[model samples]
Target: MGQFIQKTSFSEKDFLAFQDKLHQCLEALELVLERPGFGLGEPSIGAELELYLLDGEGRPVLENQAVQDTYDDPTLTLELNRYNLELNFTPLPGTGAPFTALQQQILDNLAGLNQKMDPWQGQVLPIGILPTLQERDFGPQVMTDLPRYRVLAEAVQQRRQSTGIRIEGQDSMNLVHDDVTLEGACTSFQIHYRPRGQDMVNLWNATQLVTPLMVGVSANSPLLLGHRLWHETRVPLFCQSIDGLNSQSEHPVPPPRVSFGQGWLRHSLIELFRETVQLYPPLIPILSDEDPLAVVAQGGVPKLEELRLHDGTIWSWNRPIYDPCNDPHLRIEMRVLPAGPSAADMAANAALFIGLAQGLSEDVEPLLSALPFSYARTNFYRAAQHGMGASIYWPNAHQNSLEERSLAAVLEQLLPVAEKGLIQVGVNKEEAQTWLSLISDRLQSGQTGASWQLQQYNRLVGNGHGNHEACLQLLKAYCHHSNANVPVAQWPDL
Candidate 1:
């Protein structure tokens, strides 16, 4: 709960005891749901933004981890690679247009972060993929000296089957090896929403249905290793980067740790993790001892260190998460979204999610029964696979290309339902529409960071320039836009 919390190591006894405590946590959650978790009835939303460090040329700027040490902000943390930094925002209490409030916090935090980094000529940037990222950036030496990241690197490398990369399109890149940390080139903007109650069915269905929508509007990872693959290259790159199976296990079957998702979630949050532990053995064990039961027995709060550590190991897009940080009031977080070129964009993405979750919560069983579970399960994959390029097949059952349909199309289509859903929960119409509009306008014009990056990269490559120049230009423009709090359109012609 405080800065630099102690990380617990894995033990079978701790694991089982943690599981028992986890069950206790969930039981407490159910009781609180009857009274509304945390006295803030229904889902309250939050977001996490990941960013890149760039230089004047728009290339990634390596930092002396000491760069952050100078800033003195606890929320500012190092990412796996030195070139990346993650800004963890305090949970945003949703007022419908979460972005309105969320973006202000991001702007204030980023400005503060930049002011701290300014002396080194380094600045923050949000791009699907760092335009200037190269193989040189991924060496083990470049990974931050943090114990957690170092441990994670070794765990992923040891457990991974192969470092399979196949990014082919305007630019082609295919690689297969035993290292996956290179996939760290991909940066994401993750957002979280409390689902009020264990509305698993709605959560699962909305998670699935919004796949195409999430993709259409927020596809920033269009290029990787200087190669273009799908509109959102992060889709393939991220998946293959950490794939943890041997060549013998390559043939398609449900993956053990790297989930393409088994099926729609219809059970408790614990069920999802239970299924995960059953399917994949622990990857990396850590050091820990704050027995959750010990805390419960003492009439004190438990950190659930063992369970939290295990939960940290499993990564799912629409992951079923328990918010033990706020005992008796935990929420699941959706981590599939890519970080953006703008804070407004990120907020819009959150609005659409919270709205859709509200819109679809009551319609789950009927919706799931009517729609294919496979579609819901695989929608996020498709979103990741072809961001803004794939078609979302809706329950009324119509498919539309992300590029062709535009964000407004999805917003117009889903907003009414979202509004109705939110209104049903007393979250007035004006609040819902404000945040949703950012998404609507952004999508209508095909102006996502991914789309903009693809356009600029293509323009550069089409004109016979190497990636070095292309990325440099893109990064420069992106930072300017981010600083101005302006959309990509107002960033002006390259």
Candidate 2:
């Protein structure tokens, strides 16, 4: 993880200047001929693990300072909120045994994190959505005193003019949270895979095709404002919660900055940066006169001012990423996954992603030719809204329920291809099986993170333990019960 700066006060003019600089950088691209990224034949691999720092009762814990005190490792760094922490898995250059190594390192880190939290009545839960997360948990006092986060809150609120939440299910909710901390209810398992320069276009398309399936498999955060609207309500909440456009915005409005893009990767990665720079204004600004190209000439890596700044502002689901890399010097960050029940489960999830991304690039173009994109895209929102229970609007004029084109249905068709791709990249059989099986079992049982959480929530509720506070307590208990087991069937139910 890179160092984060403390947010400083900025005038409106500062933001506008940053946007103007970004535009010039995008324009500068047109003057230079972009070349194919250089890389070895080995596949790209990366992972991001988000954890909820919790107390023994499963309530949000602020042991950030203690955790930081215990370790000097930058890889395990503080998140935007004090209750949140993130682990940036080291990049694996070649694929052989890489997943296994990542698993071991992550487990070791988790052990260390748990030990540190123990004395403080704190622990880190890997569940996709901590069932106990509630409004009380995200109040001002809990807000991490970080400049970046402050800037984000102020910037988004100023533009969106509202928190924009509306959940309707067993219960109904329509409230505005002036701040975006409500977005903090989400914690995810993020994965990154390196795509070949020659096939980047196809990989982007395949990722779009698989977005809904991905969300369905990892659905969590089903209950919001005490309602059961969707299995993975995080999707809509995140987009709508931070949307800048006011109600006056008309139809065919620009998509919220966050989205599973309808358009394909038409050109270079620079195109993504350019579109963002052109559409959304900058929210944070810390500018310098240091010429990035001059640094490149000095044999130093150029951080590409425009690209990095624009990257900070616009966050799409399947984000275009540029990171320090030995191969391709860039990788795609798949940001849609929810957190995990156990460390192994999270590792397994990451493995499944690595395999699927590699496999999809080689197989999807022809397979997707006949599939209507609108259904696939819409179904993702539906899954996020309703989780496993919603009826999916079928592709084409023909109607097909989500249960009909189930996540399991899609996985069965695609997992083997992903398996082949993972195997080709040198993952051991057990490594692949340990992770992939979780997905298989979850789909077979139709129990996503959100579903399991809701089930657990109801069990507590029937026991007269129902309330915002009870939900958090149950999350605390679930973490206590499920620690490192990957085989969900063997793991005792909550």
Candidate closest to the true structure, highest TM-score: 2
Candidate 1 residue lDDT tens string, 1-494: 21223343446774465555555544443443344334235556677777887765666777837667877777777777888888888875554445677888888988877776676677777666776777767777777766677666676776665556665566677665455457667778887766555565566656656655776567777777667666667766666667633422435443645454666666544566666555555544443545555555565555555445656766666676555454445555777677777787777677677667767776656555555756654555555555655554455423232223333355567767776766654565787777666766665665677767778877887898877788777777777787888765344556
User: Per-residue alpha-carbon lDDT of model 2 for 234-257, expressed as tens digits?
Assistant: 776677667732522443344467
lDDT, candidate 2, at 210 = 68
Displacement of the residue 337 alpha carbon in candidate 2, Å: 0.3
In order of appearance, the predictions have TM-scores of: 0.85, 0.88
Worst 10 residues of 1 by lDDT: 397-406
RMSD of each: 4.2, 3.5
Best-performing candidate as measured by lDDT: 2
